[model samples]
Target chain A: MATVSVPRAHWSGRRSTLASIRLAVLTFLADPQWLIPSMIAPIVFGFVSFELFLGTPDLVVYVILGAGMMSMWGQTLYGSGWATGQDRNIGTLEPTLSAPTPYVFVVLGRILWNVVSGLIGIVLVFVVVVVATGTVPSIDNPVAFVVLFVFTMLTLAAVGTVFAAAYVYTRYAGFVQNVGEFAFYIGTGCMFPIVILPFWTNPIALLFPPSWALDALRYASIPGYVGFSWGLGWDIVGGVATTAIYLLIAGIVFKRVERHVLEVGNLQEY
Target chain B: MSSVPAIEARGITRVFQSRKGFFYQDVTRTEALRGVDLTIETGEIFGLLGPNGAGKTTLTKILTTLLLPTSGTARVLGLDVTKDTERLRARIGLVLGGERGLYNRISARENLRYFADLYGVPLAEREKRVNEVLEWVGLTWAADRRTEEYSRGMKQKLHIARGILHRPEVLFLDEPTIGLDPKSARETRKLIRSLLGEGVTIFLTTHYMFEAEELCHRIGVLSRGRLAAVDTVAGLRDLVGGDRTIEAEDYGFEDSELAAVRHLPGVSKVVSEEYGPVTRLTIRVRTGDLTIDTVRQNLIGHGGLQVRERRTSLEDVYLDLVEEEAR
Candidate 1:
């Protein structure tokens, strides 16, 4: 085997993490059109829903939770779901993909930072909701709520990763992202109870991890609300299990799509 | 330096399937590279020259591990491009032409730093390396300015700076100076020469024959997805076998006159193109069969023509090779 002496890289794990954080911040700062809408839309929706429900205690909790979840969903959609496409548009996808570090890690790092940024928005909206509705959200089980939140974010990140991979092969990523967002908003029982919808919709909504995550959050937050067929602990368990499964599926899908893109030489194509 | 070649590609081929319209039914397969074999020794600047669609970019993509070959094997810095892609990427760098690759929103320094991290440059050395490369590319003064504000040449320089952030042993430059002013192109060429002095092996694909002749230690002329010839500049110039190229500037020359010139004794090839007010004609003839006096006299006799003997260039060699392959 012919070999050549090249300078070895001084490998450092921390550098990639730092770089991803910087990229996330830069990307966020660069696109104010997306960021402002992502932040303001959820808060506005929460307020409108609160008023529509006549400021009821139960609906206040529901709308605020929905608002927080939507904030996260928007971030994940643009930050992770459309990430590869954005890189392709910016012409950085090829160079980033060609780097020594695995492309998946770079993507995951971006997702992590986006999630962090989304958390800030979530907290702000929560504060605004509390101030406007004059109701502090009550968490019946703190541990379960925390577990459900973590699992829900992970699940969304996983779904976003799968979407990012799918975006590479198709030109209709923007359309899909828009449709998928509204689909999740309506299907996941964000503003209203999934039970109130058609009985046939229940099964389809159940397939999405966010539905169960929202169910868990609703049960844990609303006072005297024991509406779920499953108990709070069971709902939390279901969300976690579904999220883990989605993550596994996402990992497999991402790897396969990555291989396909390289084989087809479409990494640079818009 | 080690005895091992910096790059080794054997029987490499790439076939792409183009989908007709939106439907996948009427697919057409186009072979971009057909069984290419190449070896570049360590610290050597190898230039690959070809017209468009000659598989120059395809071959570079394969060696850089950006695109996998349909068949055959390639290794860079001792690592198989397909199997050890991650490792090979660490040891090699790629500079694709065009201004689209870098993040225009970020500063040149920031872009270099980001790539350094992606290349796994150590946290301690990332800053120093970014500064070193910025200065190396002569962009240190504009390091903090957003890249979108930078000129085309500056952006190209930044691309080179990013490629070298990891200090790779083998660097692939695909048309490093495609669209640039003469002075900027010359500066880029000087930068590439300095990199060669650092013992970095460069695999450059370019359309500019003059650039290739000046920088490349060896040149490979590719045509129709195959290596037509691989030799030094002088060796390629010898392909014509002592042929002298005579260039003539004339106006109001008809098609019949061009045909008459083509029938001239010992003339192997005649290329004519419009240049502003004058129509420029390039005639290649055997050195012994045709003298400058005879060619000048013939063109003068044809009426309304001015003839001069221009120096033969690698472009003449390239055009002849490509035209031969096309035939």
Candidate 2:
């Protein structure tokens, strides 16, 4: 038997917790009710109404990619925050703090589960969309897509942490989820084009990485999509960079808020 | 000084000042740990003995690096608790009261393995270590059982196993054995003793004085955010002075005559109960002065006193301590 390494402060428990949580999530996704609607609705909405929304079958590719990314964002946020509220009620957070692993490792372990769950949601969206629309999302820049995907997921996860921290403090999770949903709608271009949002909203949305990602993914997945539009290239680059900065800022802020709430020590108080 | 000890706290204090609900005008202040200083050696089992609302949990939280002390300093393994908390955390294992380990839906073995992973136990050794720790706490028979289905004693045993699973140098057990039956409690105590022999330092807190007496090499009495006393069990007993209780029946004695017996020397407090024109007086006495013949002689003159029972107990000492604090 190999020796077990003692956790240092720098060590994060992401890899291990992620593996276990992923298995649990996959097991949950195997259930029909949860697996079906979240994945199928967006695809069905895309193919049946593709011409209605985008005016052509070629644009079906962008619709599928947009729906897929939105599903990832939504499902990840949902799975990630549920445990935060439950763990606080059970009084497990304080003990987890007593361990050697950095707090981020513990938190990220929770978030990673959401991401994996989000992956399931994404896969379901992909399968349904591919079957319904009969058009696969083509990736022109797979590397950039992968990089932006991770960055977008991480940034959204950070946002989830902020709300989870708030949830632990106030137990008003409804308000937090509402704000997250609103942010997702505006930042991820779920219902509207990012270019069409007011000039001021663009900068605010750009602060989140997903805005640039949806744009980058849209441009990368469908050829001629970018050529159809101009003067928005800077939005993609600036948005990505700004989103990265916002993610860093959000992570720091989340940690501060979480520590403050823990010091107050009223996790389940209404 | 005894190789610098494993745990030390000097004037540790934790204060919480929070705003009022809704109105937010007044800030309520709670002093959870107040100027508490303590030291425990590397291999000794130290107990923090206190009752509910006595700040035992708050002090434990501070020492474990879960909450920062508002004032003073704590060092775990010579590393400052607040500044080097992560380092301190790795070296220590803490089992809090209630079921903090073993996810309710997961099997016991899976729960243990997950913790092993969190502590960075390598994948190859995780299974073996999980089994070993499970067996140590006598939970191997039910390793496949989901925690939600386990009995209270079983959950407690699994918690103990998880705390030791990482093979930490020091262990902090807060109210361990809280919900266990007599048989399970005995086994838990035995396991704790064995761990001490293996050189794992333990810091424990409990409301049960007998549990502390049986397991702790040294103990501290915490009451009302203060360390009332810290010493060996014998030392604490000495502080209260060895005291005893005597219960006797007085045959053919009325209430007025019972007053005479209560006034006897060394009998500090007396309680009388009527029994068919006979009276029974339970007396608290100083240890050296308590003797059956002496009691018999005091009551024999009336020819109505019948000595019934005499016992020296720790509860008497505990009562004295609380009484002194109340005064």
lDDT: which candidate is best?
1
TM-score of each candidate structure, all chains considered together: 0.91, 0.83
How far in Å is the alpha carbon of B20 misplaced in model 2? 3.8
DockQ of each: 0.49, 0.34
Q: What docking tier does model 1 reach? A: medium
User: What lDDT does candidate 1 reach at residue B52?
Assistant: 95
**Which tens-of-lDDT digit does each residue in B1-327 have in candidate 2?**
237678999998888787976889989898887899999888889998876887888888778777778889889878887788767777788888575544676678877766676666666777888999889888889998778888878888888888887787779999888878889888888988888756788999987878988888888888778888888876676666434677787565555555765666776666666778776776766555557677776665566556755554555555556556656
Q: Clash pairs of candidate 1?
A: none
Error of 2 at B134 (Å): 0.9
Residue-level error in angstroms, candidate 2, position A165: 5.3
User: Which TM-score value belongs to model 1?
Assistant: 0.91
lDDT for A262 (candidate 1): 74
Model 2: residues with Cα > 4 Å off, grouped in runs: A1-59, A133-151, A154-174, A196-200, A222-232, A254-262, A266-270, B122-124, B248-284, B287-289, B296-309
Please give, for residues A125-152, the per-residue lDDT of candidate 2 as tens digits.
5677677667776676677667766766
At residue A221, what lDDT does model 2 achieve?
Answer: 54
Cα shift from native, residue B248, model 1 (Å)? 6.1
Writing each residue's lDDT as its tens digit, candidate 1 over B1-327 gives 676678898999999987876566788999999889999889899999999999999999999888989999998877899888888888888999587988888788878888888898876787989999999999989999999999999999999998888888899999999999998899999999999877799999999998999999999999989888899887776675434778888775677778877888877678888878788888877555576677666566556667777557898899889988889
